[model samples]
Target: MLTKKNSFSILAIGAVVASSLVLFINSTKKQESALPPARPNIIFIFSDDHTAQAISAYGSKLTKTPNIDRIAKEGAILHTNVVTNSICGPSRATLLTGKYSHLNGYKLNEKVFDVNQPVFPEELQKNGYQTAWVGKMHLGSLPNGFDYLNVLPGQGHYYNPDFINSKNETVRYPGYVTNVVTKLSIDWLNQRDTSKPFFLVVGHKATHREWLPDAPDLGAYDNVNFPLPPTFYDDYTGREAAKDQDMTIDKTMRLKEDLKVHADYEKSGIFNRFTPEQKKPFYDYYENKISKEFDAKKLTGKALVEWKYQRYIKDYLSTARSLDRNIGELLDHLDKSGLAKNTVVIYASDQGFYMGEHGWFDKRFIYEESLKTPFVIRYPGVIKPGTQINELISNIDWAPTLLNLTGTTIPRGVQGESFLPLLTGKKVAWRKEAYYHYYEYPQPHHVYPHFGIRTDRYTLARFYEVKDFWELYDLKNDPQEMHNLYGSKGYEAITADLKAKLKKEIIHYKDDEALKIMESKL
Candidate 1:
C-alpha cells in the first residue's frame, strides 16, 4: 500500500487541482474589474425658463452657450426632449416622479408639491446614496426626499435672494443668485459623506421673468442688434386662441417692470432689495445710458415693438451669461475633486421659453418653442463623445433614466421607461411620438389650455377652455407652423389618425380631465 509510484500520483493530482482553483480566481477578478462602478454620483443642473433656442449646442444663433455646450461635446445631446406639461412646477414634478402632471398632482405653478409621494431621490436614499437639492426649487411646499435643501422661497430674485434651508428658515445670501446657488451646491459636495455616492440638483434662477442681468453682465450684448424672427408679426389667421393671447411682445411685456425703463433704483421694488453698491451697476447702465436713449428716441408703432424686442433679447442673454459661467465653475470643481470620472453631469431646463417666436414672450402653449427643452448629459466611459439623439423623449423619462443609471430598480408607479440603453448605443424599441398638455390659463399669459400629440413630421392639438378649436400643422412642410391644416381638404385621414392617437395617449396617461374634454369638446 505504500508504494513510491502511488504516492507520486496522489501528489500530482493535488497540484493540478490547486492550479485550476488559482485560474478560476483570476478570471473572477478580471470580470469584476470589467463591470461599472457600484454606484455613480449624479449632478443635475436645472435652470428655469431656459429654452433650447438659447443654447448654442441646440444650434442657437441668438446666443453662444459655450459652457453648456461642453456637455454636448463631451457626451450626448437630445434634440427632441419634450415636456409632459410645458410649465414650471408640472415639468419638475414629472421629472421627480416619472409621471405626467395629472398623476403627479402638480399641473400648475403656485401650488404645493405633494411630498408624501415617492420621488427618485427617496429611492436613491434607500439604495445607499446621499441626496441634496440646492437652489431654485420653485415648489411652494417644503421639499422631502433630500438630506439637505436650500431653495428659493418662490421665484427668487436675481440679486441678494433669500434661501429657505432644511430648517425652514429663510436666510438672505449676498450675491448673484446663480453664483450663490453654485457656491452652496459645492459647499455641500465638499462636506458630504465620502463613503456614499451623492445626487445633487443645482437649480439656477437666471433668465427667469424680469430678466435682470448680473452687475458685471449688464450690456453684455449691447452691440448685437438681434434680427427679428420670421414670424415676428404673426397674423393669427385661422388660430383663434393665438389671436386672444395677451403675451405678445407689443402688449404684455411692460416697459417699467420688464424692460427696466425709467425704474427708480431707490424705490421699494425689485431694485430696493439690492444694497447701494449692488444697485450701482444697474443704475449706471439702465438709468444713465438706456433710459436716456429711450427718451430721446420716442419710438412708436413697429419701431417701438422692435426696440422692445432688442432690449428683451439683450437682457435675457446677458442674464444667461452668469448661469453659463457658474456651470463652468461647477464643472471645474468636479475635475479638480476627482469626481469627473464617476459623476454624471446633466443640464436641462424646466421648460422651453419663447424668444420672439410668434411675437410672444411667455410659455404656456404646446408650441415647439415651449414644448421642447434642452437636455445634455456627460457620462464618462459610458456615452461616447459628440453623441446626438433625435428620438422622442419626455421629461417624465428623466427620473427613470437617472434611476437606471445608478442601478436602482425603477418603481412600477413610474410611467416612463429609462433611456439608458439609447445612451449606451444599444438598438432598442423606442417611442415614435410624444404627448403634450398645457393647463395654466386665464390669468398671466391667457394661453388657452390644450392637449395634443406630436409625431416626427406633424403636430396636432385641440385647444379648449376659453376657446374650443382644433389646430394641425405639418412640421415638415411648414416648420414655422404659420399655416393651419386641421380641416383642410385631402387631410381628413391625417386629422382622424392624430385624433385617434391623441385619444389613445390620453387614456394611456390616465388623464381623466383630458379624456372628458376630448369626448365633450372635440
Candidate 2:
C-alpha cells in the first residue's frame, strides 16, 4: 500500500547505507596493511682490507672493535662468507652489480670498471631512494648513478687526499683521509632529503697496506704486543707452490723500503723543520726505538722480519681503532635524528686481509685469509637483533638484497640472490656453496689466476697459467688451510664432486671469458 515516490526514496536510502559501510571497511583494511611506511633508510659503512678476524664480534681475541661489533649485536652477522673476485676493484664491482668480475668488466686494479652498466644504486634511485657514496670507492672508474659522491682516486693517500666530487672536480682536502671522509659522510647524511628514504655508503680507508693511523691514534697499540699467529713462521715446506711464492712476511718485508724506518744517521733532517716541541713526540716514539733496534742492533734477516710484523700489526690495529670511533659518530647521528628505528645499517670490507696468517701480509689469494670478507647488517623492524646466518653469501648478493629491501625488482643477468629471507630468520634454502676467482696474475703479488668452489665441508681450487695444479682441503679439519689433499688417497671422490660443481658454477655464472682463457692455456 506504499506510493511509488515513497518506494523510490526507501530504495535510495538502502543503497546509500550499503555504500557507506563498504567504504568504511575498505578504509580500515588499508589502514591496517599499508606496507609499514615503505621501509627504513640504509647506511652501508664499507672499509678497505678489514678482516672478519679483526672484529671482536666475529670472535677476535687480538683487538677490540666495539663500534663495528655493535652492528652484529644490533643485527645479524653472516657467518659463512662469499667473495666472487677477491681483489679490491673487482670485489667492489661485484658488490655493486651482484655479478662476477668478468661480467662487470672489472678484472683487476689495472682494468677500469664500466660505469654505464646498471648498478645497484641506480635501481634504488629509480625506486625513489636518495643514494649517496662518500669516501674510498676504489673502483677503477668514477662512480655513477649516485645522487652525490665524494671518492678518492686509486690507493688514496692517508694525508691530504684528493677527492672527486659529483661535478667530476678533483679537489684536495687538508686533513687525515679517514677524518675528512667521515666528516663528509656525516655532513651528507645531515643534509639529505628527509621526506624520502636515503641510502648512504661511507667508505673508510683504514687498515690497508702500509697502515697509517691518525695523529690521535698514533701510539694506541704500542703497549700491546700482539700474539703471533700459530702459522706466523710457517715455512710452506709441504706445499711446493706456496713455498715458491714470494709473499712471506719474514723474507720479503724490508726495513728501509717496506717499513719506512731509518736511523739518526740516515734521517734526512726532515725533523729539522719542526720546533723542539713538535720534535719531542717524534723523537720519543721513533728515535729511541730506531736507535735501539736499527742503530744499535741493526735489525736484519730474521730479526728484522719479526720487527716488521710487530710494527705492521700494531699500526694496522691502531688505524682500525680510529675507524671504529668514527663509525660510532655515524651511529650516534642516526640515534639522535630518530632514524635508528627505521634505518638499515650494514658494515663490510672490500675483501679480507692477511694479518701474518700463513706468513703473509697482503691479499690476492683464494686462501681463507684473503677470501672471507666481513659482513654485518642491522634492520630494526624486519630483522631480529643479534641474528646470525650460516648460509654462504657473496659480495654480489649485496645488490639484490638492497633491491629487495626497497621493493624494487632485481634485473636479470645478475648472479646474486636476495638474502632478505635470511635476514628475517625465514627458513629459505640459499646457495650451499660459493665460487671465487682471482684474475690478477703475473702482476702485483704474482698470484696466478685461479677459480674454485667452497662447500660447507670442503674447498677445491685450480690454479692456471704457470702452475696448472689443483688443491683441495677439508675446511672442517684444516680451517687454516695448511694441508693440500688434491692427490691424497682418501679424498678422490670428494675432489671429483667439487670439481664438477665448480664447472657448473663457471658455466651458470656465464664466465665465458674465464673459460676461454683457461681452455686456451690447457
Candidate 3:
C-alpha cells in the first residue's frame, strides 16, 4: 500500500532499531561483567578413621568436639550419611569419581586407582574452580584433578611425615602431622588466586590405626575412664561372620607397637623416626609410668580385655584432640579472613570407625557402627543454622551434590543424586535406602566380603565369596543387630522384598557381576 520511497524509509528505521538492540545487549553484558561472582567457595575438612560416636555433636560422653561441632551448629547435620565401601582408599575413590567401586576400578585397598578415569574435581576445575588437596590421599598414586596437591605417601606417619608434592618430590615437614597439614592448607589459601572460586580439600591422618597423639596431648584423657562396650566380650553366639573377624581390641591390638608399651621394636621404625628428645618423653611416660603400673596390676582374661579397651580409647581420643583443635583453628582463619560467609564448610571422615562395637576395631561390615559416617555441612546463605537432616545419603552421591551446589553441570555416568534439596528443606522426594559393598577380606582385617542395603528401619546383607549366607536385621527392634532374621517363617515378605530391591539396585548401578550373583541366588 506504500510507495517505493516510504518502503525505503521503513527499511532504514528497521536498521536503526537493530543497531540499538546490539548496543543494549553490549551494555547489559558489560554490566554483568562488573558484578561479583556468585559461586561459593568450598572448604572440605576430612579426617581419617574418625567415628561419629567420637564427635560431641553426635552425642559422645567420652570426648567433646566443640570445633567440629561448629559446622553442624552453623548448618545441617546428616544422620544417615553412609559410604559405599567402609575402607580408606576405596572411599576416597568413590568421592572422586561419584561412581561405585566396581565401576571406578578401585574396589579394594589392594587395587590401584585408575587415574585416567574422569573425576568430579576435574570437572570442577574446568568450571573455573581452583581445586587443591592437602594431606593424606591414599589412592595408591599421586592424585589427578587438583591444581595444588601435597599428599602423604602410603599410610603416612603421624609425626615428621613425608609429603609428595605436585612436582613428585618428597618433602619432609617438621612438627605433628595435624599441625603441618593445617599450616600447608592455610598457606595455599593465602597464595591461591582469589579471583576464582576454590574447592580446597584438607585431609588429616589423625585417629587412624596405631593411634598416636601429639606430645602435648599424650595424657589428655588420662583423667577420664571410658566405659567398655556392653558387647566387649561378645561370644559371637549366632553370627558366623562376627566369630571370625580378627580386629578385636583384646586379641589384635599390639601393646608394644600400637599401644606405645615402650618395648623395643627397633626394626618397626616407629620410634626410630623420632629424635632422642622425642623418644625420651615417650619412654618416660609409657615405660616408666604406665608400663610400671601395668606390671603391678597383672590383669588377666576379662580384666585384661577391659584394661586394653581403656588404653586404646585414651590414646585414640588424644589423637582426635589435635584433629578437633586444628579444625577450630581453620574455622577461625576463615572467619578472620572474611571467607566464612561465602565458604561452604564441610566435615566428614574417610569412613566411620568402630569404637570397639561388635568386639571389633576396624570397619568392613554393613553394621550400623561401621556403615554410618559423620557428615556436617555449613553454607551460610543456603543452609539454615542448627538443621539436622534424616535423609539417606551415600558417598557416591557426594560429587553430584557438590557439583549441583556450585551450579556446574554434572557429567553423565555419575551414580549419585544431589541432596541439595534436602538441605534447603524442599519437599522433593529423596532416596529411601543406601547401597553398600565391601571387598577386602583375609588381609588387614579378616571380615568376609559382603553387600547389603540399609533402609530407614532395616538392613539385609549377603556374605559371599567364602560362604553363602544371608543376614537380616530389623533395625527398629534390634538396633544393635544381635539377631539375624534371614529365613524366619514370619519374615517371608520382607526378605523377598529386600532381595528384589537389592537386585534392582545392582542392575541400576550396572554391577553386572553382582547382578549375576544375585540372580543365581534368587
Candidate 4:
C-alpha cells in the first residue's frame, strides 16, 4: 500500500534529524571545555625555621631542596620576603590575620592566639571553598578558620608525634613527624568535599631546634663538611644586644639534647615516646656511631666548636631531608590525582634561622638571617615558569594575596596589600620598605625587644626596654651588618631620613608601644 516517493521522503527526513542532534551535542561539549575552573585550589606548605640559605632555590650552598626548588623553578620566588615579627607564634598569627604582632594580640609564644577573630580561610569557606590545617600550628589554641583541623600540640616531637584532631582528641600517629603530617594531609585531601575547591595549610615541624632526622636520613650529610659563614666569629663589638644573647652555636646549643652526643636511648624524654623499632636507627646512628666518634675525639676549644657546628649541620640538614621528601610525596599525590593543573602550591617558613651565622643558632635578632624568610609559589596557569620577583614583600601580605587569588574579599582592618598583581605581570605601586618588630626577650634568648625598618639599602633599628641604643647598617656596603652606622659622622643625613621613615611606619601600623619608645629615643 506504500508508494516509492513517500518512502524516499521519510528516509531523507530521518537523516536530517540525525545530523541536527550530532551538531547540538558537539556545541555543548565545546562550551563545557571553554569554561575555566571556578577557583584554584591552594596548598600552602609551611615549615619552621627554614632559612633561605638552606633552600637551593634561594642559592643555598648548604643543601639541595629539590622539591622546594621545583616550586621556584615552576613559578616565582621572593627575594625579600620579610617577617613582621621574627618568632614562630607571632609569625603564624600575622599570616592568619594579615596584621602585625601588636594588632593581632599574639606577641609572644606563651600567649594564646585569639581564634574568634576573622581569618582569610574563613573568607574562603564563605566563598565555597573547603579549608583544612594539618600539622604544626603553634598558635596555642584550636584553629577556627578550618573545617578540618589536625595539628601538633607544642613543638611536635620528630618521631611518633601526637596530633590533636578537630574532635579535641590527641591521637598518636606512629611514624616520623614529617611523613605522618603529609599522610594526614593527603588523607584529608582524599576525604574532603571534592566538589568544592580546597585551601590546605600543610604545616611541618621540620628543621626546628633539636633537629632530629628521619631514620633513613640518619647520615645524609655526614661526609659534607659545611663551610663556616664569613661572620661566624662576629665579636659583637658595637652591638650590645648581640653580645648579651645566650643563643650561640658555641655555648647555648646543648651537647646531649641538640647534638645527640651520648643521647640515652632508654631515657624518659622525647626518646621514650619513640617505639623500640623507631629508637634502633636513632640510637645506632647517634649513640653507637656519632657519640663514639665524638668521645674519641675529646675535641677542645675552636676544634670542639667546629665539631659541634658540623654535627649540628648534619642533623639539621638530615631533618630537612625528610621535610623535602615529604613535600615531594605531597606533590606527587596532587599530580596523580589530577589536582596539579588547578592548584597553587606555596612553600615558606615561619622565620629564618641562623646556620652558624654570627656564631648563633636561635632566631630572635632582627638581622638579615632571621628577618628574611624564603617564599616560593607555583601556580600553573597564572604564574609563569621561572619568574623571579625582587620586590620587597612581608609575611603579613600572605593572607591578602591568598584572598585575592581566590577572588575573595580581603576583610577590613587587614593591613597587608595583595601582591597578586605582581604574579599576573601587572605594574602596581608596591611597598618600598618592610617593617619588623621583635618582642620576646630576657628569658628565652635575651635578644632585647626591638623594632626596625629595612629599606632597599639600609636597616635602621632601635633596641629598647633594657638597652635604649640604635643600630643602623648600610646594607649595600655592610651586607654582613658588621659596621653599625647609627652615630657615625659621615652618614648623618641618611640616618635622619631613615629614622623619620621608621617613625612614620610605626605610627601607620598603630603600634602605640613602638611609637612611644621611638619618640622617647628621638
Error of 2 at 123 (Å): 0.7
| Candidate 1 vs 4: which has more TM-score | 1
Candidate 3 collision pairs:
none
- Position 317, candidate 4: lDDT: 91
Model 2: which ten-residue window has the lowest total lDDT?
Answer: 263-272
Top TM-score model: 1
Instruction: Give the lDDT of residue 416 in candidate 3.
Output: 96
What's the TM-score of each model vs. the native?
0.96, 0.91, 0.93, 0.93
Q: Give me the displacement of residue 242 in model 3, in angstroms.
A: 1.0
RMSD of 1: 2.2
TM-score of 2: 0.91
The regions of model 3 sitting more than 4 angstroms off are 1-37
What are the lDDT figures for the candidates, one per model?
0.91, 0.81, 0.89, 0.91
State the lDDT of candidate 3 residue by residue for 230-282, as single tens digits.
77767877778888889998899888887877567366666667667766777
lDDT of 3: 0.89
TM-score of 4: 0.93
Task: List model 2 lDDT by residue over 156-226, tens digit each.
Answer: 76767789888889998877778888899889888988878999889888877667566677678778877
The residue pairs found clashing in candidate 4 are none
